[model samples]
Target: MPPIQLVVFDMAGTTVTDQHEVERCFTEAAAQTSLPVSPERILAVQGMGKRQVFQMLWAEQLGEQHPELERHVNTSYAAFRHILETHYQTQGASPTEGCLDTFAYLHKRGIAIALTTGFYRAVTDIILEKLGWLDGLNEQHVGTSDSLIQASVASDEVAEGRPAPLLIERAMHLLGVTDPKAVVNVGDTPSDLLSGQAAGVRLNLGVVNGTHSLDQLQPHPHDQLLASLAELPAVLEAL
Candidate 1:
């Protein structure tokens, strides 16, 4: 063991396979407030912050109809929150394939585990409750930094979201991490790969059990790629 301090995990795709419900909730909510026509467009904007995702989805639905789509976005996000509370948060979602054993191995070894997501407080709570791992989260270790300075987004965790390292940096700080290069970032999307890259972490493990396939994830190939988290231990041992 090299004394890995924190194993930072991505909330949605990394920890749980709830993208289907998550996407549907957003699309439905946005639609209720006059937006989107298809799930494919929303999927294309995957890995972005909720607000931007909503804006993009709504913009696509409107299709150059409104010069200012903020109002519709705002309404949709609100409705999205409601939908999440009812459907997504209530029903919950499944964890990524092999996530449990991998996490258990780390935690059992006294390695710290942290979850970072682009989701907001309320909706994320539903997810946490569903996973029953909310108790493991250290509120202080969470990151919602970029949105703090970028006020136009209307969310403290929406500014740069995943693709930026801000969230990872914030998580490391809260975890009392000293060496940035020692951390490991595991995610299911290219955005997460980009974020881990920005954090300067020496290891970034990408899994194909979520958003992208080998062909899509290859452009931003991770340090290691596997079918699922089950391959993580071997990857770590090799590291």
Candidate 2:
């Protein structure tokens, strides 16, 4: 097997500490917009793009051909963005347990690290800035050239988000990694696993420290399911 040249991580659940705040934000936004969405429904689509989530929920509630579907989606999504941004800005962001250690481990081995998120660029930036992960990022690509992480790909930067290969493929492109088999993709959601699988990454790992538990993610296709990112280095070493 080829050595892992790059490791792509998910932002909210995989590397960052998310206390279900994202789901809360989504639910609050839907209520603010007079859209009734169940908490279970919101959690089911955790890793999807914020706008796409709204679109899907609205489509389900009002039908795909509803004349006002686009308007409702736009309104709810805008509200979601505001709520989410304010939540991160005020509540602050923190790295998941052992996430920094994992980054250091990969850095010491000359492996490139990248972050991909279902968030748009603005909120993504706010969280990275809070975590001080943007210290050496390139303004042009909005990724690091010399920092521990090489790239940060937001859902807004790609043509599509999770469950689509675009985000992973874009991260690989930005990091100058050409071979999919030389990559490892890790996240905490089913969409993250699906994205990695679609990208043909060598390792499609699901970490249980974020949005989903081991049992929740067990139904998804992944090479391995980890208790947390702390176990990642060991798994990589074994592979």
Candidate 3:
């Protein structure tokens, strides 16, 4: 059997943990600030970078001119970040089941495991450090969480991110993986699914372990679906 080359990931729902508390956190912040961000609004931006979430909510709820929304989101997000940093290491933000085992197995098989989140470097590093998730990873080899940043990469690198293939392309290049047929992308969000599809990766598997329901996630043409990352190894074995 041929080996899987690179297994790329989206961090929040893919590796960090689940969102049961996250909504509560958002709700608490919204009530405190009296902003328009609701639990569902927060859910819409679950896999996004923290700042991006703020920006999205700002635009949708407050408009581009409202710096107050930015302030509110930052302050609110800071509150959440503090809590997460304290507890997320051991508890995880909502890491999918079996993700650790699958990632470990991929490493053992010499399949490069790469990750990208919507986070900025500081936030990304904090989560990785707190969770000890980046313990064995090489900083140079890992892709930075620069998804929403302009000037993030050179034009030759990738086309776009999420629903676009740019981030995966960058990860593949950094890992020296050239074959689209030998790679897979595992994620819990539809954005991840569409990103894989855009990158032309060999497999794009969706997991219901994140905020999105299967019905909403099903329209994107995923190659496979599972209830959790726990099913990943067996799925790979079958593949």
Candidate 4:
């Protein structure tokens, strides 16, 4: 209602191209650590914090009271971080189709851009740096209106990740956006849409070209579902 002051986007699957490299890393780490979780299970928690996913899977497999649960979770998560960091560092990351164009469209209209992700701060920085999206942000990851993006919130920065409104709320805080109705949440996972719904954003959007398909996302609560970021400008205009 307030002209969409801020648009909070999920990084890996929404703005950035994932290519399932993240899932492959998770699978490799689980195998190496003997975590005993299936790829399907990992895929199911795609938009959750990486460490949280390990803890959940390990707890599911070993029972919450198991003495070795913490050890197993720690080992698996450490391995995941190492593998994921190396892969992103070596392979690099690119923006999703039309992501930059969408950003520019918002920029020209004086709307803020905030990128929230299930990734921890380190890997999030790596990916943003590679994409040149980190140019204007300070150490705290909050940038000015002149920056490419006005804010970024990593899962590590919050008490909880997707399916929780903390990341979106945190971004709103950083960007000085007060009304949920003035925000648009865009991501490529079910958790992404759920978080947006929880945050009470005006538009909770699911993009099909990322981690999940239309059928996969159809059951989730969202205001609209999009093919990709390419269609975002028109959607925003129609609002």
List TM-score per model, in order: 0.82, 0.97, 0.74, 0.98
Candidate ranking under lDDT, highest first, comes to: 4, 2, 1, 3
What is residue 20's positional error in candidate 3, in angstroms? 2.4
Query: Over the stretch 70-181, how does candidate 3's per-residue lDDT look in tens digits?
Result: 6776776676666555555555443468877776676566667777665545556666666555554554535323211111122123333455677777777776778877
Q: Which candidate is the best by lDDT?
A: 4
lDDT of the candidates, in the order given: 0.68, 0.91, 0.65, 0.93
What does candidate 2's lDDT look like per residue over 5-87, in tens digits? 99999999889999999999998999999998898888889988889899999999999999999999999999999999999
Comparing 2 with 4 on TM-score, the higher-scoring candidate is 4
* Cα shift from native, residue 217, model 2 (Å): 0.2
Write one digit per residue (lDDT tens) for candidate 4, span 1-239. Answer: 57889999999889999899999999999899987877777778999988999989998898999999999999999999999999989999999999999999999999999999999999999999989999999988999889999999999999998889999999999878899999999999999999999999999999999999999999999988899999999999998
Error of 1 at 40 (Å): 3.5
User: Which prediction has more favorable lDDT, 2 or 4?
Assistant: 4
Cand. 1 Cα-lDDT: 0.68
Best by TM-score: 4
Write down the TM-score for model 3: 0.74
Candidate 3, residue 106: the lDDT equals 66
- Global lDDT of model 3: 0.65
